[model samples]
Target: MGETYGLLSLLPIAVVVITAIITKKVIEPLILGTVVGAILLYGFSFFPNWVGDLLATMSDPDVVWTMVIPALFGILIAMFGQSNAGTAFRELAIKYVKNKQNSLLATYIFGIIIFMDEYMNALLIGGTMRNLTDKFKVPREVLAYVTNSTGTPVSVLLPFSSWAVFLMGLYGSSELLDGDGFTTYLSTIPFMVYPMITLIIVLLFIFRKVPMTKYVKEAVARAEKGNLFPEGSGPDTEGFEDELEENSGNTKKPRLINFVLPIIVLVAGTIMFDMDLIIGVILAIVTCFILYRLNGTMTYSELFDTSVKGIQDMVELIVLIIAIFLLVRVNENLGTIEYVITSVEPLITPLLLPGITLLVVAFLGFTTGNYWGTMGIVLPIILPLTQMSDVNTSLVLGAMVSGGVFGSHVCFFGDAVTLTSASTQVSNMSQIRVSFPYALAGLILSFFIFLGLGLIV
Candidate 1:
């Protein structure tokens, strides 16, 4: 462990955080940070080392699983979009969404229902419900907030999701824990304070039991005056607008089954396959293809084209995830987590471990904009600390998971934020600014909850 570069090990991630915040970009900063880490470790010969790490990280099985599952979901979502499934579902839900509060309620409900993955939740809910929210004079920021809030928070809280599966895989492989990964994860569910609290806050805001931040309040005022999108406040959504237009042109009467059946297959298949999301996603895609083909909604050629387009759309995000994996590898080689543990080891007693873990992991998650990557880096370090101090492992583990969700929730460049912005047509920065206050509230509340629980348990 002393082979670590000590204090210097912090350089790479610091570079990422500083550059990311300054530029409000994700991939470029990630790449630059990895390069900085490589240079720190290998000097001028860093090129070969960086390339090797990049290749190895890209080929990692877990990394592959993460990338592949989302890409498959992308293809499935494209099919759903092309077949007007989301539109059909939106129409069904719109009946109950006759007012502003009802629209928020409907969006919140659908966001929870599509909890297989954050990506799916954001894409489906934001795309499907934006128009409904718009009709009720709800700001796109509010829609983005509802969509983004429910995205990771819901997925992480639910045991049967890509988030839980990925975390379990990480925990399962760790030598520090004694139980099966799935069961251990289930143990942490009740203590996952940040996400659970976040969901509660989202509900409170939805029902007007809690006042929104000034940004959201202002946006709401703007929205009620016939401006659903604040000027210069969102992404360039012409492409999505075109897609929505094409979806609206579907000649067949929109059947609710076209939307609901594939998702049912996804959820049921996942349960049947021992919670492997890949199988569920593939099953959903196949179900969509067969259903669409038989219904004459899309031809074979059209289905193939849409499938390919979906994969193409995911290419950029996949590359971003790969960049995140590369940074994780660089951190490992630099012994970043080891350095952190070593530097802080003396202060990490049993009583403070959970709170400190949450703060540390949350900072890493926020700065890096990669919850899984941050978890991969920190959990190994955390498990050893939990073991050494005889702390309640489940409590600290819950804090770690909560911190990752908080980071993902608040990070401006996180994939959830980007997806929500795209689907809701809200700007990425604007979404972050609008949601950060709420996210911070969750973080502060969760920190105390972990601390209190640590002392009690």
Candidate 2:
């Protein structure tokens, strides 16, 4: 067996993490980490002849294609941009974002409404408000803050979200009204600490003049003076046709259908067939060509031409996805994630469980930068509570999720963290620095909350 603690096993992981932090790029770190691991396992004294096997595994098409589908799914979205779908969507959003106060309050209100599902709320609110939020220069993190804070707050309180279904699956209903374990799960929704506290914090941040950061402040200052950020970014007519191929924006209204129809296929197909997101996205990209042909946006030859054009639109987003993946992978391989989890387990105790849960989950989120993984582990493990008959599982699970989300909101390395930063054009550090105080306050309040919860339950 391989030595878990030896330098050979750790070198790859170390390089990956250090490089990721310094460069803030994901794919390069991931590729480099894998290469290092292969080197360690195959250095002359090691499995010298096994280099081929290691290489084959790393080159596995599945690894590359996993993201391909989601990327394609993203392309389907690009079609919308090329046409008029995005403009239509923006018009609808503007009606809602009417003003900053409306935008901020709406962010909270929707956060509460999307209670039935966390992921749905995340994408729906985040994507929908991209235009409006950008117009307001509301710092992508604030949108993230609102989306994240509300996503869980509502889910934990509502019995209809994926969590409810998960609990139902975990503890099959006994049929009677109160006999169902899910009901206990549902009742505990109020007990969820971090999300609830986070909701309150967002409300205050919105109503109060809580200065966020220089960039956020800049956005606000501009908005106060009535200005907007760059629009139709990523790529443009000049960027694609003039810069890339010397073509011009000739595709017309048909372009709109080319976008909408493909997205319907992607979202509907992915959700209905439960297809992998990456696969669904890829298919959507292909669909764009087919639809373009059918709708007259391009002929077969032009298909290749505009395909390049359409892809250019998503170039920044694609780069972001790859970078995020590499960084995430490298960090995982390095053992930083492992150390984060085990190091704090021993520190957990009954009296300290609530506060510690926040700290530990925050650290776990920082290390793994995962919202779901933190919940899965902390909720199941943690101190002496797995066997306690008197202890309510709801309170426990809530604390875990709350703490996890708190960390995720600020973890400069996590997916959501990166997504918010990249989409908003703010440096990752700016998002982190701006959001930290809010997350910390939520963590503190949640600690006391679980303390009171401990007695009530």
Candidate 3:
């Protein structure tokens, strides 16, 4: 910021992007970047400076809100697991799914419907649909594709999701934004081009309107011969199968009410609470407690244990959130965004902002395999730039969202891809190879759409 670094202001970000890509990890790179930025800012005294700044970041109200909300959603999800509601919902839906085509379609639809969280969506859809898809001779790659495609994209696009709440909290908490986060998020919905296009592409592929890649075609052909994967070539389960079995096993048959009622409370309560996601999730948890208790699905001790386990389940996410906040603070000190804007401002017009934002964020998201982390770094930068340039706020925000989802959709090492691969027992690389072309197609279309809209709107 003080011309101490000039172009070197970008060093930390470069370290983060490059390290993340090379190592296929997010937290370590983010931490390393933060350390690098801190050193750049405070020289030999970086340790205390870093700790102070990180503590400040951790204590920020919005950061606390972000941390709390995800844990709450985890609790709600755990409750859903205890109720076997996802299984119930799956059982109910699979009743009508009689073939490969319908099985894929049903997986896609369920992926969208289970929009509360991406992890839940990936695991639920992949785990529940795997046997059915296998029965119908659908390749694991295909199942992985449908599951991964719908995971982050749909979760981010919809308002009721953990992704949405986290994003909205980020937007509203930014001092650059004057509008309410929920309203701003709703405004971005229509312009979120990538997810909509990706969903359409999935639908087209499901209906056989889109041609499969040769690899996918080969996989499909193999599946038709009753081989879901090449012998010994599937991903190492790494205990995922056992984890899934442990989590999903229920002696009692899954009741539809156990699945449907809590979700209804969540959505309806959120709306009733004026879009307060935390309260909404709390209400849903309470509803789950009562419903499960009345139905004897869980005793008080079991319920409490599940609640604690749920919070435990979210520790990794919470740690990532903390690291993201730390990196953001370090970047602020390094003036990373400030340097970027100064260098790019003369070259970038408002008409180019949306498309450029999409491309840049998409590249970052894909390389980092951390969509939320990427957004945490860029949103602070982009929001300020948008205000200065007078670009359409929602348009640019939409592009940002679209780009993040695009990256998550195709990145082989991304959480969604990893989880889906593990859940469906396909190699992570195999799913990415199968899904990349379609994701790329959507990316191209989204970039053009953003460009045109930037010109017109």
Candidate 4:
């Protein structure tokens, strides 16, 4: 259960990736990985006991709270779409964004502006922009890619975001760091090559400078043929479209206020009240309901049903998140992360440490599908290594952040990917397949950037 197992602790992650590639499925691989990790942690005799422990961990108040925030956000998104606020916004956006290029650009801008929380950014922006992107034949996969890439990357880059606050606390508490944690975080910003490069890469895609991948090209081709989704690959929006149609018969017009005001309340509430994302979303949902009802846009019963429908739409994503949480728990109990760090200790040097740490953290984050968890486990270990190895602290810190961002963007089961898929109504695997090449391109670029910085800094 500790670092005593050394390299053997990596078997679970290997199992996950190999199984996933072979099966082309995520849930089974994740479950298999978790079970293997449990067996490794507790042995054959206590394997049943480990399952009980995992369940108990998943039910912890903090864990449940984290899970609920996304579910509530899902409800808010569903309400937006159901109330035709998303449609209204799309119509409004189309006025300024007359073509595919401007539509994608507009989506990216919204992602940057909603940087307070990654989950909110993905759900709100993805939901609002999907119809607009559809109008221009900009493929759901492309929309998913834009929303997914910008979600975590933008949050990590912004100083006022949840990511920054969590990282500040992490760095502040670390004995290895010498200066104020906030200042140290700020210093690492310039060296955060991955997210910065990721944004640039997205911009290139928006401007049509980057070539579309095969999947994206196919998606675009299909859209040109008047197909919104590839054959057999659309979200289960059975009741969603029906509800929107029913609401269309109402006398109230689809004003931009229905879309804009709720988001303002959600963002402002989060910052001003220092509220949890769940609270902010709850307030937004209430505001949307009040506005829609007062304007006679939707009946009270219709609003309640649509909100529930929205929550139902996110059921798959919520389940994926819980499964991932269990996988993370199993990884912790198996000490997989600790093994990776300690195994790399003997090979690290001042010049190579930054690039090496970035790779290792990236591997862990990609495997675990939880970048925040990767950071929590990795920074504590790698920061101490940097203190003793004569490495440039800021560069190493930047590398860690870069790796986390890259992993979040690429991992198929990562929260950002799942949430983006759910919000944009694209399948999770479709989003990953289309976006993998681009993410890899960024990762390769980041590795070289870090390697050069490692030598100079």
Best by TM-score: 3
Q: Itemize residue pairs with steric clashes in candidate 3.
A: none
Q: Write one digit per residue (lDDT tens) for candidate 1, span 1-457.
A: 3255888887877787677667766678788989998999899999998899889987877677767866786788677767776667678887666789989888988888777678767767887788788788899988888889987888998876668767765665555688767788999998898999999999998998987788888988888898888667654652355554454566665767777898899889988998777888898889988998888888999899999988987787677777876776777778776677667778777888898889988887787686776676567667768887888888989999999998888887778787778788877777787889989888998888887998788
Higher-ranked by lDDT: 1 or 2: 1
The Cα local distance difference test for each model comes to 0.80, 0.52, 0.84, 0.74
Residue 162, candidate 3: Cα error in Å is: 2.0
lDDT of 4 by residue, 1-457 (tens): 5467666677766776677556656566767777877777778755687678667756765456655665676677666656666456556667798898999998998788667567667766776787788888888878989998987888888765557755765565455578755678889999899999899999998887899887887888888988877554675732234333354443446677887898888877766765445567778889988999998888899899988886786676555555556666666667665666667678767777888878887887676675665665566567657877877888999999999998888888777887787777777788888788998899888988888987788
TM-score of each: 0.85, 0.52, 0.95, 0.68
Q: How many residue pairs clash in each candidate?
A: 1, 12, 0, 0
Alpha-carbon deviation at 94 in model 2, angstroms: 2.9
Ranking by TM-score: 3, 1, 4, 2
RMSD of each: 3.4, 9.3, 1.8, 5.8
For model 2, the stretches where C-alpha displacement exceeds 4 angstroms are 1-90, 96-98, 106-130, 133-187, 209-219, 222-349, 388-390
- Rank the candidate models, highest lDDT first: 3, 1, 4, 2
What residue runs in model 3 are displaced by over 4 Å at the alpha carbon? 1-5, 234-239
Q: Output the TM-score of candidate 2.
A: 0.52
In candidate 1, stretches whose alpha carbon ends up further than 4 angstroms from where it belongs are: 36-44, 159-162, 165-185, 212-225, 231-253, 333-338, 363-373, 426-434
Predicted candidate 2 versus true structure: per-residue lDDT over 1-457, tens digit per residue: 2225344445655565566556655556545665665555445543443345444433444334422433343345334434433334445446767666677676666556444445445544555455666665564556666666666566656544444444442232111114444445655567667776677777877877565656556656655564443223232311112322211132354333554566566556556654344444556667877776666655676555555654564454344334333333333344433444455445445555555666777766666554443443344334234233335555665666667667667777765555444434444565566678777777777788778877766
